[model samples]
Target: MSQKSQNQRPDEQPEEPKADDVADSSGTRAAEPAPAQDEAADEVAPADAATVPTGTDGPVEGPGTADGAPGDRDPAGRDALDRALTDDMNFRTPDEIRSGDATQYPAHEASAAPEDDRPSAEAPPEPDAARDREPETAASLTADRLLDARDRAPVAGWRRWLYRATLGRVNVGDSDAVRLRRLRENSIKTPLTGGTRYVTVLSRKGGVGKTTATTLLGMALAEVREDRVAALDANPDRGTLSDRSPGQTRYTARQLVQNRYLVDSFAKISQYASRQGSRLHVLASDTDPHVAEAFDDADYRAVTDLMGKFYSIVLTDSGTGMVHSVMQGSLEKSDVVVLVSGASVDEARLASETLSWLEAHGRQDLARNAIVVINQSAGLARGVNVDEIEAHFSSRVDSVVRLPYDAHLAEGSEVSLDRLRPATREAVMELASLVVDELRGTR
Candidate 1:
């Protein structure tokens, strides 16, 4: 046979044919016996026979192969396959894949982006510049703040009149003559009574007419009710109460506060009480300030307890100082509290602060029992307005007693029912009547 025929020919066989040869021979067709067997043998080789590609469009070379054993390719092609595999497996966009090395894969199907980047849902909201930059509205300012500021501001003209309406005149003013005329016109010819009513004037602030108002109120209460009344200057400072009274008296309120034993003797107590004729008594403060300070809470309580029993009304002139525990105790125990303040802005602001302090210290009930009396001591023709003054106080002003400026009243002259100016006297009388009604209801 020729070489071509030899290449295509079947292998020689034994006379007794093997089982494998017989099976192979039967399976192969006559036309392609040898070639078919070779192809079958190639397919049966291990997976490692084919290597990863290197260079471009070629199998990757194995360790010792120059052009590489089977599949070989350039670095570019290898990188492309890596990128394609990453894209298919990771679902990353083509743009992201092309940007750099494709070593990492994107996670599959993440949820939509959150509104804020912060991890916490409870983060505080950021302020908007537009809203913050807007001008403040009238409602932004509180009534209390406005009133407090107003009390500090100075007054002019009609403002002065307004001040007088709330705070009665502390010192003699332009209206003194007119006030006197009014008092003379309004004077009643009623006879004085021996039944006395006592009152106590007090304030946390100095120069707010605590002493002056007490003196004037005592006189007015006596004059209007025709009842016996006394103004006891209980201030340890030995203030102006005695100077306001016309009668001469040696014994003072200090003596009574210090000597509880003496309080038992009506005669001894009477000796201390300054007689201002039929309806009024004046218990002046001691001239020595240190002596006044010597009295304590027990002494004050003893004196008041004794006096309360005897006098129908006892008016105490507590001085303006925060250090006096006895006076503060007396205020707490009193039937009513008269919180005096001037029309000036400082006085009003201070009054409000003091009232707030009192309320904060579980003294709301005490504050409720208080009556605000505005003292217009400076006598400005037109002073702080009544409404304005009320605006400054934490508590309500129960009444606006307008005591006009009266030189005669301040002069410390002889005591006479006719001496008080009309406007001042009428206002005081009205106050006295109010007090009477209040006391009567309590009784």
Candidate 2:
């Protein structure tokens, strides 16, 4: 009703007070400002008071308004304005903010704070001058780089040990003469224990050069060493040795066994012995096959014992038959036994069976002395692989001798060492070498 009311026309009569305003009896103004024009214009305005501020301090601040400078609000608004300012100082740009929002709120005065608390934008790089002046040494490099020049670098612990064990340690030094001399002295100093003088050549199956090994071994010792070497044919089917060495003396083993007293004297027995070569004597088997059965254990012992006195090496050619009393006696007195077998699977199998039989008959000690010789007769048979045969025998093979099946040698004719081919002669010589090394302990 005052002058302000008189000026207003009816058409201009103030619109009904907005919902934010209401009359109060005190006369002091009390009204809520209308909501933002944009908010009011849209009917679907948000209900949260935090989102839309009220009252007439221009527009009440929003979250975005916190970026403004301080001292911009009324004293009554200081608390909330100060808090909002603090939040704004802490708030980071999109690029600066970590995704999880883990940063602590900053103090309201952070923007005005000293430079010491904040990090510098640019930092100096490492100095090349300092690095160039530093000392360089092998220790400075990594271990891998240090060994890069080696052909094969050693590994650590078990891996290194395993490698060295698989392929034996490489010896880089030359053999010394002093070491060789010492080895020879050690061998010579060890005396012989007067071992059994008997020698055996055995083949479970025939035609594997067993007879040839026995004969040639005797011939070698006699011809090469000038030692008294005697060859005894114990084959039940006697005459194999004499048949192989034609024109050999006709003195038979049957004659010696017949006269037991003559076995004691080597000079008296020398007449009955047929000289094959220099000192090689043949105590040929009886011309009669049944004579082997006629001789007993005593005859075998007497012949071996008496012969041992005069002969350094006594070679026995055993037949492929089961053990007879005479054969057992001969095997018992033998110092070394030679088992001969061919490369054929059948020969190997039979040899294995024969070895088992010898072991069962308490002749394992003799079996240990057995040496397997692979005879390549006629040169047609495949060269026998010693390793494969050893697998069947369950022991290391001693030697392999290949005899070229010569027509002259096969006939009942006298064949001298010179008559053989060089290769054949070398093979025989190798066998001789093995035998001499084993019996005489000579290389």
Pick the lDDT winner.
2
Q: For residues 216-332, what per-residue lDDT tens digits would candidate 1 score against the true structure? A: 667766555433466666665556776766667887665676675646655667778766553567777668744525556665666667776666677888867555866666666
Residue 116's lDDT in candidate 1: 68
| Model 1 C-alpha lDDT versus the unseen true structure | 0.57
For each candidate in turn, the TM-score is 0.50, 0.51
Question: Tens digit of lDDT per residue, candidate 2, span 1-443?
Answer: 12443365545535565434565676556544334442223333224322322224343453323334222233445556557634643664332332434454444444555777566767665579967894644333533334432334234445446456656343222224333433333332232336435677887777776777777667655665534678887766654776665355656776776675756677878766777444678777777644536545676677777677777677888776556666777676766677777667777778767768778888776566566666655344466665666565545444445555555455435546667665666556666655654664421
Off by over 4 Å in 2: 1-196, 276-278, 289-293, 382-387, 390-395, 398-408, 440-443
Measured with C-alpha atoms, the lDDT of residue 67 in candidate 2 is 38
Candidate 2, residue 436: Cα displacement in angstroms equals 2.7
- Ten-residue segment with the worst summed lDDT in candidate 2? 184-193
